[model samples]
Target: MLLKQMTAAALAAALSLFLSGSVTAAAEEHYDVYHYDCWSEAVPSQAGYTAERAVSGQDLGVGNFSEPTDIFRDSHDRFYIVDSGNDRIVVTDAELETVEKVFDTFTMPDGSETALNSPQGVYVAPETELLYIADYDNSRVLISDYDGNVQREITKPDSELFSQELTFLPQKVLADKAGNVYIVLGNITTGAAMFSSDGVFQGYYGANTVQTTPEVIVNHFRKLLSTDEMRSRQARTVPSGITNFDLDDEGFIYTCSQSTSQTQDTVKKLNAAGANLFSSLGVTWGDIRSYYDTNTNTNYQPMICDIEISDDKSINCLDLTTGRVFQYDKEGSLLFIFGSKSDQLGGFTEVTALESCGESIYVVDKRKNTVTVFAETDFGSLVHKATELYNAGYYEEALAPWYQVLQYDGNYVRAYEGIASGLLVKGDYEGSMRYAKLADSNSRYNKAFEGYRQEWLSAHFTQVAIVVILVAAVLTGLHFYRKKHIAKTETAERSEQP
Candidate 1:
């Protein structure tokens, strides 16, 4: 009984907290989470690509990479690569050298030792340092630690609850700040999967409506094709070999719908409430080229084969064919483009993954089996960008750059406050309140927000009328109860006198 009482009390306290809207790690209503793409930069050059000691490139001697497909970083800043062709994962220091066997042997869920056929995605939870692998061949997401300790296979959502469709050959697996892993089943036709931090299957999203290259195109290309033509045709379905699946610290998932010759490709974003946000902003590599092509321009031919987000919330897409990396905003605004077709250890060739850790950027090139590091001092400029947008009255636009500022340096309290101001300028009171709390952290905006919120409530609802009616009813109930009790007591006394 005592334990039950304590549990109830605790639950009540939680309910009160929710009602008061004090804490927000969890929310009473739907949480609004948005995702921004970071900038993409080229891997440093090697062949005649000498750095000023400030720059570092990948160095693989003899036993290096066969087909380095993916790269991931653990909490300890250790790098892991899916050396697909070699059927192993390579571990190295911050510099992509000194290859060590992080996981010597890995297998399918059925204990079949057939090797990880094209392991594509690897994710490491910073908290637990547990690594999750999307084993494409085994059709399972293998869970383990950074030290190669095998955990368990993530199962499918129970078939009884939802009718199973197709078996997913997982591709890219990404983790948000909360440690939930989202996987892209290789066959876009099979859709994608989601799992909890502990490897428990959550649910699946999307459908097989993915656009793939038509059978006719593949058949036609099979008949008349040189080596180059064959490669290009094969990539028609997945133009960029890079994983489009990525995350912001917030719980939004950014996955490209399908890469093709279509006028536009959908970038399916699932919000915090599992709402599918449909947009076609950054998925149009072909369209971007057509703009140049239609104008009889040759300079705009896109050779991008990879994409990654920088710390600044802009996309960096590497043109493998051109050896260039382009950064674009959410609305497809080209911020900048760097690099040209260069085949060198430091320059990008067969480049794979790009990740941002504060002011530094990491680009892993599988051909070199190496990771290159670039330190950018211009992150402060990212703050200036947000400030410029805010000043220009583009409050919504400022929100993203402000977020980037905080991501690059959490100590930038001014950026947090700017986010609050931007939200206010956007006329999103609730959103303004959310960031304002974080900006102040001492409930400094409590009075202002409460006053605004109450004013909003009065205008938005029949709250005042409801309160008046409720108060009147409560008073009436108390008066009737007291009168009834006295009458009963008087009746009892009269009966005794008789």
Candidate 2:
């Protein structure tokens, strides 16, 4: 009874926090915070993206959706909504207004029919027009052509690479250009389960590292002192499980691991060899610290639930706790952050997935059973143009767009850095230094200072040399005259004494 009472009290406290945060957010309705650097925060003068509209079940002509899980937009711009609760997939046109087709049954090759069991994820291969579904209850990956004919089914591997004792439930899945399939299993802490095109289980790919704490280190020492039998009973640390993943146009798989306790490598770009190119740049993937909400007096750690990679290499990570989608450029610089947790149109109850179309972003709300589309604002366009040029090393050419970004949001730190880089390239060191200071880029400021100092020295070298020569000659003449005067005085005194 005491334990139950304590649990109830804890739940109530958590509910209070959520209610307070939602109330404050609804009252203000501002999604303006962007992380500039590890220690700095900036608010845009204008919202980068705004929720233009929401598409619910009523719009899909499907009465009402219960716990819709995933949303995907294929190359042909067709929208695929995985209606998990209904045990079916809803297909819509590019405009998302008309329902094109509904996938409820799969036609098997052996003159039989099978149905999906609470599919959580759906992926349509852009080239081959293949559909991959993670049938949760069925514990298999269902692959079919656009016509709903089951081409192949991926069950648990029969090889020793897979553990027979463990369940093979897949939550999310994606396919690469080479027909390689990757599935994110919820209970697998190793990584996403990888398989070849022939349905052969290869191995786990891109596993997160174990977060080392003081307790972990102590346990390691304790194991060294214990017997083998005792060591077997000790707890073994493991990597966090990957939640969801999406494939970019270039075939790199971008994944998100929803672990609030582990901060490192929450989002990653894994190459064909399963190496994380994101961490190779030595930068953090998301916000450096947990966001502190003053209204709720709570520190909301970022739990990245989903990732969407754009054609421009922009990575969008959806945070479940704050309902904010943190978007980063190709090189890991934060582009913009927008969203909130509320019952309003632009807000989200639960952010389950994110999908990127050309100029808009679609976020699926599991609780609301709707997908909210966010259209890019003029500010967002300017920011993207500037960031694209900046990341491409076209600093001078990016000046116009970067300045245009300032016109929209003067607080944008990247714009200042972009302008500074342009000025530095144009040999305007003083201007570069000024902008770099505003951007808080110490390396840029130092380089600009060095250039300014060198220019100053070069411009005044001749004048400085002439002054030095004149001072030396004057000193020598004064010394000789003083010596002659002393000698003459000595001669006169000697004559008088004689």
In Å, residue 462's CA in model 2 sits off its true spot by 1.0
| Top of the candidates by lDDT | 2
Question: Distance from true position, residue 235, model 2, in Å?
Answer: 2.4
lDDT of 1 by residue, 149-242 (tens): 4666764556453347856667778767776777776544434566777776776654324334566467557646657666665534333222
- Evaluate all candidate structures by whole-model CA lDDT and list the values in order: 0.57, 0.86
Clashing pairs in 2: none
Candidate 2 Cα misplacement greater than 4 A, ranges: 1-39, 42-45, 280-282, 292-298, 468-498
Q: Write the per-residue lDDT of candidate 2 for residues 1-498, one digit (tens) a residue.
A: 999999999999999999999854432434554545424644434567888889998887976777888999988889899989999999988888889889989998786999989999999988789999999999999999988899999998897877889999999999888898999997889898989998999999988888787777898899889999998898887778988898887777888889866777888888878788888676555565667999999888888999998878898999998898888898888887888888888899988988888889999999999989888877788899889888989999999999988876678888999999999998999999999999989999999999999999899999989999999999999999999999999999999997
Model 2 lDDT at residue 315: 88
